[model samples]
Target: MWYRISSSTVIWVANREIPINSTSGVLKLTTSGTLNIFRNTSDLTPIWSSNASFSVQNPVAELRENGNFVIREENDDNPVSFFWQSFDHPTDTLFSGMKLGKNFVTGQEWYLSCWKNSDDPAQGEYTYRLDPTGYPHNVIMKGQNLTFQTGAWNGVRFSGRPKSSGNTMYTHKVVINKEEVYYMFEQINSSVSRLMINQSGKGQRWTWLQQAQKWSILYEVPSDNCDNYNICGAYGDCNINNGPVCGCLEKFVPIDVDAWTKGDWGSGCTRKKPLDCQKGDGFRKYSHIKEPDTLSTWIDERINLKECKKSCLRNCSCMAYASLNISKGETGCLQWFGDLKDIREVSEGGADLFIRVAFSDSDREKNKATFIISLSVVGGVCLLGLPLAFCIWKIIKKKSKLKRSKGILQGSPKGILRGSSKEHSNMSQKEDPDLPYFSLTTLLHATNNFANSNKIGQGGFGPVFKGILEDGQQVAVKCLSETSTQGTNEFMNEVKFIAKLQHRNLVRLLGYCTDEENKMLIYEYMPNKSLDWHIFNEFRNKLLDWPKRFHIIDGIARGLLYLHQDSRLRIVHRDLKASNILLDVKMDAKISDFGTARSFRENETTASTNQLAGTFGYMPPEYALDGILSVKSDVFSFGVLALETVCGKRNREFIHSDHLQHLSGHAWRLHREGRTLELVHQNISQESDYALEMIRTIHIALLCVQQSREERPDMATVVLMLGSNGELPMPSQPGFFTEGNIVGSDADDNTLLEGR
Candidate 1:
């Protein structure tokens, strides 16, 4: 039996089906180099054996640190090439270094079979393994039934599993070659992880948590209704966020509409117009979607997308085509023939797929619009025979009416508001087409006329109130206070910048209200409140163990990365502190407060302003002193936030009896003395298993808070560093390191500045 030493939990059993039924069982190696387990010393028949192919001079049975029981020659210096390893036949739990694929050359496959139950070590009905049929992908099986699939490997990550990429805890990848094909993950740090399939046929990734002293579920497969393999059938797109969870692609209609309405989407969909491939069908592009299954696909790594399109057009049977590797500048082609299946909409990191369609269906909408406009113009000219001067005057009058309706302000035509006049009422909606508008009466009813009891939190821009709309949707209403330090410019700036952004980690903007003197912004309600509410409170801080703290740190880093590089606009969040980070029901972090944020053009890297606006301790030295701002400014703020999170104290208000220095300076001092684990909060310091991870986080924070901004890593590199175990460089002393003296020069409010 192979068991965990700490818990004595048996993960694998060699003789699960046949019990030895004796307490005097002995395991011994024979001269033939076979490892055998006998019922007793007097018994000659062996019950189990390593069964080595041939005899060896001296065979040694050893268990490796990564939980691999191996047999090797005694004097052999090679560590990897063992004669036999228990990893080759994993029973249930797959450790970090184990492979879950097959070797075609040796005809040996590695896979996982779950235990029969919690008490039984026998193999269960479920199996999880890599399938190499068409394009390699992970699949889950229950007996003979295909329960779920992880989609195909799309270079960066699995097509169906977008969250698997850029993970902070571990790095996962799939390797394909003539000799072998396998999927494996390696730990980024000292954390222990196991990927296992339970008896219920559910695949889950569990990480050992030191503070909790138990295994915490990092992720699970079949996580949603959409994860069911072929849930939507052929040519159907599954979007979990949608009402029905299944919908047909554009220009396609359900084959059985009544069945679909009844929630039986198994019949899938069919094209409205029949495809005439011989007549040269064109392809319609679909973005932000999981590419179709690659079962009947052809891949060419040498061709570009343009050439891939040409090649697909030449083949009558080709149904869809996409870039083989999304990360490598579209250098390869992945074309699917026949009907598309198992396609879903992924909110983030989804690939673009182009499906072949009839030429009439391809440009049907565009051609119809053009034909309607042309017919209208001809009909007007023939029917009325109007004079040129009269026609021009009518067009000018219509243009004037549109301009007035747009409510362009006197000085700011881009719709930046001054006062709450009727003209400025519809300005936000007109400027940001994606942003919805909320009526003043609706907000009044939601917040019960801004009652004091309804207020949740207060900020520089305004006070936040918890509200429930008429539709029973919970919302956070950020009502601008009469004595607010931030002006209308900052309010409009937040609307303009955050309206176009969509990210899981960023707070979502639901709608805005601009009713006379009352201005407010509505957001999805965050139940757990902000990070400061939990991390700073004496009683609440205990809920944030080491694992939860690390999770928050990773979430904040990813959110900042999205703002810096992944979003459509390059944004610099000047105010990123503990209070600005909100927690959801699951304790996932969502960044808020975009009032002091600034955006840059594609090629623009840095900007300077006479106004320095942000919290005092969170701002970098250059940004606070010289009014210089960039993405690095946010990185510096994140560093401070990370430190405060780890230590469970505010940087600006930190009071240590041993030193008068701020939190950054104190952390640096402890790090220099090789006592970095001391920086962990006392509430969570007893988690000795996470000491190394906490030290690494502190080291990363120090690197971000270094004196020179040039030395700071970009968000992408920072994310990589956080998720990797490679050696990091030595960090210098943090900026603004002072003893008992805090710098507050040429400033307005120390807490926040209406920088916009």
Candidate 2:
């Protein structure tokens, strides 16, 4: 909001947090020639000043075209020879070529601090800059906490930022040549472009598009959950494509299984076998990874990879070492002395890091070879029994046939799945015959070996691809990564629960497969994909008319009812939310993603757990806050989903001008004002039919999301309320939707908030 004659808006304020309330406000040069902002009401009150304690003999100030306001000696007309400049200290916005780090000689720190909120210019929690210590990784900090981290300088760009390397739009660098350490970006095109650190701490680079009369987002950092700092603690690695997300490096185990099982990885992993420290100690190479936190790291440019490893091995205290520069084929040395933290495996763009461990952990291979030879000699004599081999083949054929009988086949990926135990067959666990399986070859051909074109999207679980089988049937394939922390537990949950479920409203689980290393699930594809895609997308929302939206709401209710009461297993779909609701070609809704589903006996309906995992916004107050779950928990999520559908907005990401918490808060406000219809999506309004049904549906949604779990309506009653012309009960305020005391905008803005 900076300006022209038509509007005198200050786009960038020098002292934004301080307001000059009276017309008596004045900007003047003092007797000593230092400039300051002052008001008549309080002569001594200085809102802002040049900080020139000993003023120059002749001082002058000027605003450069690049938006730098500088004060310097009048005799020195050169712009670069300035005493002070506004660009040196930033507030929320960063322009091209701004130094954002340290002037070591002067002990000065320059960084970007976010405004309090979107409109308030007061300082907020987020700060972005080069943290000069431990080799200067660009970081985004929320107060004292590290929210995000970029690549450590790898002699090129930040080593972890693939996007920053080889970019034509701008040249980026981290300069640390003794006098200072700083990070700065020089744009190829500087006009009308600014990189803003939004109030939410998102680093967004916007370039104006004259033709579209809009700002285009070039890219942003903390792009996904993996960018979160120390998401996986010491000796653990984070892969966003994994369930439970955090996992230990090979041979390490969770320090606390109870906490990790409940989705807490803070007490990460410890060595299965501790290092013997130079006594039969060896370095295990970890490829394709972002290095751990460098708080206690040492770096030297003069050494090569060979010298680096030797130096680390020479020191008993050194825990790990890596090449300093990723660009130059593993050159230079970077060493960590103590605990390793904040490590993650990258899908692409990462360096190789080697961790030292004891040789005892590798001794199993030598012992296993001896065991194999002894077994081979014994099996030679057993081969004389031919009739037994035929019997074994017959039993396997029978099992294979039974697997195909249900229109789903089960098998392991060829040469991919290893029993993690033996040579005859690699079976990690006892094979379950309840669900059918799909062979890896079949799925590979169906999805082009999981090609990018076929990829629909990725979630915490892994990458999902849309595939076409030989029978002309389209299916969605979930390729479970071997490194995924979900392990076998979540996979079995989806298999056990979705297999026996028979309902039009529920997603059909065609089958599942486990190759030597690959784990996959085949589900019937939905042409319309997930509910969130259509409802939250502004352009797509127009396509979903009021009738279609109402239909979806009804379908979701029926699906939830089936889960709560009609299903063979009295199951609770614990992770229900918009993204979990898949839509078929005709826009019919189906409840999906049964990975978190839990079944209870009819007599036993409620359960509790210490840790929680689910999208945040749709989680019930009782379930989320206290871990009590039941059919009512699903009902609470349904309430949020239904409300979002009607409003064509997301509960978690909703923004309000009035400072309301989210969509639910705004809806509650509208309900009290007798203007609930105003909460409906603008696109849905053109078709005025079903206006009354729309209003009634919003009321029912409110009843479903009431703060008290006992007051909320069950899914069965919700269906009756929607289908029949019945009066809805008065609803209380929804959970997490107050005007004050909210953590984030969306309920399930889907952070690793489960740990909280």
**Model 2, C-alpha of 332: deviation from truth (Å):** 1.9
Q: Write the per-residue lDDT of candidate 2 for residues 1-756, one digit (tens) a residue.
A: 242321422346666778566588878767676767886646877788867756677777777777677787889967598777777767777777688899979888888888786456778889888888787888889999888877567766654554232446666677887899888777686345667776667776666545534444555666545667887778888864454568898878899989988878888899998878747566778866787877788999989998998888889888888888866777889998888888877544567787877765543444667899989966964885767767877999998666443323453222222112122113423455656667767887898766766777665566678888897577899765544435466776787788889897999999887654456778988756788877776655765666568778988998888888887889888788888889864467899888778898989878987767677787887877778988889998888898999988888778887786778878888998899889888877654546788889999988988888899988889877886777677898888877444454343223334533
Clashing pairs in 1: none
Best by lDDT: 1
Highest TM-score scorer: 1
The lDDT of each candidate is 0.79, 0.74
Question: How high is each candidate's TM-score?
Answer: 0.55, 0.54
Model 1, residue 755: what's the lDDT?
44
- Model 1: residues with Cα > 4 Å off, grouped in runs: 1-10, 19-25, 39-43, 163-166, 363-756
Lowest summed lDDT window (length 10), candidate 2 = 416-425
- Report the C-alpha lDDT of model 1 over 88-147, residue by residue, as the tens digit: 888888878899999999999999998776656678899999988777889999887787
lDDT score, candidate 2, position 665: 76
- Residue 457 CA displacement from its true place in model 2, Å: 8.2
> After superposing candidate 2, which stretches have Cα over 4 Å from the reference?
1-12, 22-24, 30-33, 40-45, 53-58, 75-77, 159-167, 190-192, 218-223, 360-756
